[model samples]
Every structure is written in structure tokens, then in C-alpha cells.
Target: MPDAPPSAAPVEESTEDWRRRNVGRLLNEAVRRFESRVLERLAEQGFHGVRLAHVGVTRNLDVAGTRPTELAYRASMTKQAMGELIGQCVDLGLVRREPDPADGRAKIVRFTDQGLHFLEHFRRAVVAAQGEMGENLGEERVRALLETLWDYVHPDGT
Candidate 1:
């Protein structure tokens, strides 16, 4: 039989901690859990087919339609990566690609009629999830958390 791995020994210094958890990791985990809760609420409301991966497209998307480059910038992903997600959205009947009016060479990503409906569901899902979080963590705490994160994200409040 294979031997088990050695057990982790607690380190005296936090920097020497084996777990290696940190601020960025905590923030990433919180965002993921929040989105997962949103997805659960969406599914409970009879909305399906939407998945976490779609957030990269849907969350950054402008209602008036936006170019993939702008979406990538907003989502903090590569243009090519967002393009692949956009393709997935197209296949899922969530969005369509159209030639940009002013920029003939670029394409704009717009939601399909179905996608608009999905957007409503997405909005409701997020609110419901946030409500649950507020219930669990107290409304004041939730509000503070949102404000804190927003401040950190946009230090200049532009």
C-alpha cells in the first residue's frame, strides 16, 4: 500500500503558514461563493442553462451591446478568452454578434431576446442571493461589506 503524505505542522510565523491563504484568495473565494449562490437561486426560479462561466460575458456586458475588447477589459480577461466565452454565449442562444456601425472591422456582442429575459432572471437571482447573505450576515454588515469592497476596487471612486 502507498504511504500517506506527511502531516502539516503549524508554523510559528504567519508567513511560514502552509495553508498559504491570503487576502486575494479570500476575496476570490467570497466572489465565487456569492456567484454560486446567485446561480442556485436562478436555477430555483426555473432559469437554467446559465452557468458561472457565462458571468464573464453577462456581467460585463452593456445593455446597448459592447465590443469584445471592452468586455475583456471590463472582465479583466484576454480578448481571445472573452471571444471564446462570447462564442459559448452564442451557442447557448444568449447573445448574437453583429458588425459595429461606426467600426466596420469590429463586432459588437448583443443579447438575444432570450438573453434579455435571462438578464432579468440574473438580476433577480443576484438580489435574492444578496438578500440571503444579508439575512445570514446582517443587513448592515452586508452593506458595509459591499461598500468596503467597492472602495477597495475603485480607490478614486471614479
Candidate 2:
């Protein structure tokens, strides 16, 4: 007899297996979970205005302050997008813009006292989140994961 035709239906992948095996998805889920914990803690501490979207710029911000262009570049965003986020931060009284000493036409964004307070809260929340992650994943695994991520992010130690 002649060979029958092949099946037309595509093979399906198990969602659980995919979730467990995809490195990008795993990393993204981990980040989401961590950010959720941090934001929840921030909310508990009365930092109600901060949102997940704000984190892209806020977390990348330099402690000594930086220009909008630089912040935008670091956050992998455009200057206009960074400017909008900065305006929101200004309205929230978290940051303020001052003329840059090195360049008269450019402005540097610096955290206000209120912003400093928020940063302290964020630091605490991050520590708490890390502790929780360690409790769930075990200390050694968590440390290894962090070290691996650090190496991935800074390949040449730069």
C-alpha cells in the first residue's frame, strides 16, 4: 500500500515545560515577582505614587544625579520619554532639575529630600525581597543566580 499523508496539526508544547525551560521567560518572571514585592513594600511604606513604569528610569538613576539624556540612554529610552518620567517625578516632589554646571543649556536631575526618603524605602524593600527569594530558593542558589546575572550584565567587569 502507498504511504498515508502526514498529519496537518502542529505539535503542542507543554506550558509548564516551556515556563521552566525558557531562560528569558524565567528571568522576566523573576524580575516581575521581585518588582511586585518591592512595589508592595513601597506602598506599605506610603510611597503610593511610584509605579512600575517609573522604575525603568528611577532604578537606573545615578546617586549623584545625571542629565536627562544620560538617564534616557542608560534606561534604553528616548530623551522625550525620560523627560516625561522626570516631569512626573518632579510633580511627585521626588526630583528637581537644575542647570548643569558643565553645560549651561543642559539640566541635571537630582533627587529631593523626599526622593531620598523614597530611595531608602526602596533599598529596604529590595533587601527584604532578596531575603524572601533566598528563603524560597536557598541561599547558595540565590547567590549563584545573582553572581551569574552580574557576570552576564558586566561581561568585562566594566
Q: What is the lDDT of residue 128 in candidate 1?
A: 87
TM-score of each: 0.84, 0.85
Per-residue lDDT tens digits for candidate 2, residues 1-158, read: 95333333432574344434456765787899999999999999998889886767678778789999999999888999999999999998888999999999999999889888888898999999999999999999999999999999999997
Candidate 1 per-residue lDDT, tens place, 1-158, comes to 95333344543564534344445655687888999999888788776777887967998889999999999999898998899999999998889999999899999999999889889989998898899889999999999999988999899996
Model 1, clash count? Answer: 0
TM-score of 2: 0.85
Candidate 2 clash pair list: none
User: Can you list the residue pairs that collide in candidate 1?
Assistant: none
For all candidates, the clash counts are 0, 0
Best by TM-score: 2
